[model samples]
Target chain A: MQLDATDRQLIDLYQRDLPVCDRPFLDVSRQLGITEEEVIGRLQSLQDHQVVSRVGPVFEHSRAGASLLAAVAAPEQQLDLVAARINRAPGVNHNYAREHTYNLWFVMTAPDETVLEERLGELEQQLRLPMLRLPMVEGYHIDLGFEIDWEALP
Target chain B: MSTCTSPSDNGSTLDEQDRKLVLATQAGLPLVSDPWGALGQQLGMDHEDVLSRFQRMQETGAIRRVAAVPDHYKLGYRFNGMTVWDVRDDAIAEMGQRVGELPFVSHCYRRPRHLPYWNYNLFAMVHGTSRDEVEAKAGQIRKLLGATSAGDTILYSSAILKKTGLRLRKEKATS
Candidate 1:
């Protein structure tokens, strides 16, 4: 979709969360010199368009909780079925088909470890596949949230 | 302060700017005096509109989080692994709640275990600043879950790789 200058401006604001306040949109509207309604209208447009995925508390993984990225190997024909099965499971945030031995891969997050194991066991039997749990061993960072294929401007 | 919200009824599809919003905010808003102000200036929109819209989007379910990405490897315990286990039915959800609370375990969930190399379930990511720290944490998990046997592969992230948020857009059908 072609992005107009104003749309780009709106998006830039979306990228940056509104201030933490009683009326964040109102605060933002005040800053940008636009009505709070306009702010809501544009965001509604962006979301209706599917440009934004989620917006909530940026949980500090290191400070408070934890998470992991892992994958599984599945026959090509069963990829769809397997993916659907995996995706159906609770706590399964995102899944990707990598060009590797592990054809099916996904990320999971939860409030706590006992949960991980019990569920892993159930998943194996339920989906009937070996869910290779390859968590991050060492990393300066573990978030794969960026645009993998974004072509930076020259 | 307000519960996050989304614009579920707007019905407008995502464009490039919207995509950029997902990408930029996926990581988390920067820690600054006027983070939204900066973002509005960059996008050329009124900050209030952006703020209100974000609140609305989060209030709805379309957008999931504005979570902080922590520096786990830096902090003491270092080893990280994708610990997969075999669990019984009717107990999976109960177990997930348990695993999610561990300070060391960053991620936990259930996924499909295909077969052969994949026959494990219940996944969790444990982070330690050190390898031994990671093992100790994993051992703690084993005790908590009561698994007969378990497996974990250490994914030493070779690189930082890609880190961004996803914004799924609907493509109009072509006649």
Candidate 2:
């Protein structure tokens, strides 16, 4: 979907630090020189087209819960089955098939370490495959929102 | 005020009310014009109270930002690569910061390496419109790492098996 100037501007402007007040859209509309309804409508449309996933608070990774990056080298034939099984676990949020021997990679999170560990253990037993558990030691950048090069995007 | 909190003390500062707020908005804020008011109504807190709690959370680093999250794939950033680097342990902190500051690098972190299988400790995600673009960006990072970098590779994601961001289980509230 091609975003017009207003839509692009609204996205770039409000990707971070949206106003914290009643009628936040009103404040944003004023800045965009459009009515509050227009802002809401455009956002709604953008969402419908899957351009904008959602407008929400991004919680700090550590502050919210415990999470780790994990990978498994599922056999090529059973890759889809393994992925479906991994996705069934509530904590397994982001899973991907990467170009490597250890193809299936995912991230899992739980309320705390104990629960996260228990879930991981159960998953390991269930998969019966050697899994690489790579927990983050430190984050150099923690999602301050990426700068979208409008020209590059379709 | 000290803003730095250790990862080991996860969720220690958040009280029951804060957890409620987190649960309420973790998925996404209501799309209504008066979202704070709508949330206030749902949680039985005044709109002003809801706003203040979120403000406090932002100040304390509990909330990174409350904003629109764009889908990279939808936005035409089709190629996404997980660029991994094996940097000298002594230079990792400095090198990771430099690599993360690059415009193309989205998420960068130092993770533990499972020796024999995984030699890379630093991971930086690069996204682009094509494989060549992503490879070029990875090349820039490779140049940046220089001598401190032992080896590196880009793991291009072939498919998204699952993409649910995160969900705080309701059962955890009772725990």
Candidate 3:
């Protein structure tokens, strides 16, 4: 779906620091000079088109829970089967197939370290594969929001 | 650009009530005119209480931001690369700070390396409109790293097997 000027402006504006209030959309509508209904309508449309994932708060990784980036070298023929098994685990938020020997990579988050470790251990035992456990030691950037170069977008 | 800070430094832990709020809104805020009011109704919180809780979380760094998360692929960022660099241990901290400041680099971190198979410790996620664009951006990073960079590789994602935000398990009843 092609985004009009208003749609682009609305998205760019609300990508960060959305007002915290009872009628946050009303506040946004006033800024955009559109009706509150239009603001809601536009957002709903964007979501329907899968352009916007959701209107929400992004939590700090460690603050929310224990998390890790892990990968496995799933055998070529069993890649889909392995990925499906990994995806079945509740804590696995993201699973991607990358172009490498360690083909499947995923991120897992649990309420705490004990649960996280237990889940990882169980998965390793079940798969009978050595998972590369790469946990972040330090984050160099604050995930404020991505600044999209709107003009470049197709 | 903001400098790097350890996640642990943001020291406030979530209380029971705060955790409840987090669980309720992790999926998203209600897409209504009065989203806070709707959330309050669901969580048994008043409008002011919900607002203040979210504000406090934002201040404490528990909440990064309340915003619309765009689908990069839909926004013309088709090429995504997990660019990994094996930088000199002594220079990683400084190098990571500079690398993360680049506009195209979405996420950057220092992660532990597993020998023999994985040796890159510095990971930066780069998104671009094309493979050439991503490679060009990675080239910029290479130039920046200079001699501090031992080696690097870009692990381009072939497919998204599954994607979702962090989800907290429903608390089990305590005896």
Among the numbered candidates, top lDDT falls to 2
- Tens digit per residue, CA lDDT, model 3, A84-122: 999998689899999999999999888788989998999
Against the native complex, each candidate's DockQ, computed on alpha carbons, is 0.06, 0.73, 0.69
lDDT of 1 by residue, A121-151 (tens): 6777888776666554333212322211112
Tell me the lDDT of model 2 at B96.
Answer: 96
Among these predictions, the greatest DockQ belongs to: 2
Model 2 lDDT tens row, A45-152? 888888988888888867767988999999999999899989998698899999999999999899888988998999988999988999999899766656888887
Kindly report the docking quality category of candidate 2: medium
Judging by TM-score against the true structure, name the best candidate.
Answer: 2
Write one digit per residue (lDDT tens) for candidate 1, span B20-96: 44445653453334456666676776667566545544554234344322233322223446566665545656666
Weakest ten-residue segment in model 1 chain A by summed lDDT: A145-154
Model 1 regions lying over 4 Å from their true place: A1-19, A22-154, B1-20, B23-32, B75-77, B147-175
Q: What DockQ would you assign to candidate 2?
A: 0.73
lDDT of 3 at A40: 93
DockQ of prediction 1? 0.06
Give the Cα-based TM-score of candidate 1 against the true structure.
0.48
- 1 against 3, candidate with superior lDDT: 3
